[model samples]
Target: MVTIDQANQDFAQKVQSMDGGETLMLCFQCGTCTASCPSGRLTAYKTRKLIRKAQLGLEDEVLSSPDLWMCTTCYSCMERCPRGVEIVDIITLLRNLAVEKGVMSAPHKKVGEMLVKFGATVPLNSEYEDKREALGLARKPANTLGDEKALADVKKILKATGFEDLVGGN
Candidate 1:
């Protein structure tokens, strides 16, 4: 049986393997992150639980948790962490790991595809265009769906980051 120290050491090693997860080990379990998280209050989300899972080397629990995806990148937890742990960065790392491990669903994968294809999560359909025009804004040019140069840059970054494989394609 593993001792508490041994378990903690193992968790530390696992967190260290992640790009931005090294800071997660510094958390003191003060519950500040959970109290500060906006999503935790609304949903069953709990940032503190995620930190505990990471601290215990509960890899499957951390990777497959919807709480990790619920974070809005709002940085509230990061700001509240007294140990200066990069809470948002840790969440992002968990999200990337989840996606890479195929724990995320097809709809989640499609969101990435949509972002790659349209440069936005929400497709700017004709109704949106009509609403923009009705609000007195000039109609965007037909070719203004997505900026070509920006899309190319995004594709290059995604390819370099192995995000294409994470989402299962371009």
Candidate 2:
């Protein structure tokens, strides 16, 4: 049911040109990646099918798929690939492309927002602080937790990458 106009003829080429995406065209649809995917066992995420879609230039379908975000990035598929395709990396690249287009799930947006505001995805909550203190560690790890300079640097990078705007963060 796919129409010709829906395909981006240069999609695969563009993927190949990106770092960590060089091995994309080497995929032969052996299904090894899909078979080895732990996420596929639980979710409807079929790595092989996604690769085929990319090969066939189904750009919109591939990028906008909710299944794209289901990968746990465990590298199980990459380890098992007979063709040595960087499946996880390709997924990451696709995710970046999707984000560039401002297509992202709510949870991912929330995480990005948290990163923008707090400079960390897991903010310094009381539960985490208590656990750290109990373990003889500083309540806030010496990272970007409450460090204004570090947080500002993170915001600068996010702003430079246009991620702050993508996630609706100031």
Per TM-score, the best of the predicted structures is 2
Residue 143 of model 1 has an lDDT of: 39
RMSD, every candidate, angstroms: 3.9, 1.7
**Model 1 lDDT per residue over 43-120, tens place:** 999988888778887777678777778888899889878999988888887777776677875677788887667656
How well is each residue in 35-108 modelled by candidate 2, as lDDT tens digits? 88889999998999998898889999999999889888899999999998999999999999998777887888
Candidate lDDT values, in order: 0.77, 0.90
Model 1 clash pairs are none
Best by lDDT: 2
Q: Which pairs clash in model 2?
A: none
lDDT (C-alpha) at residue 160 in model 2: 96
Q: What's the lDDT for residue 87 in model 1?
A: 83
| TM-score per model over all chains | 0.75, 0.90
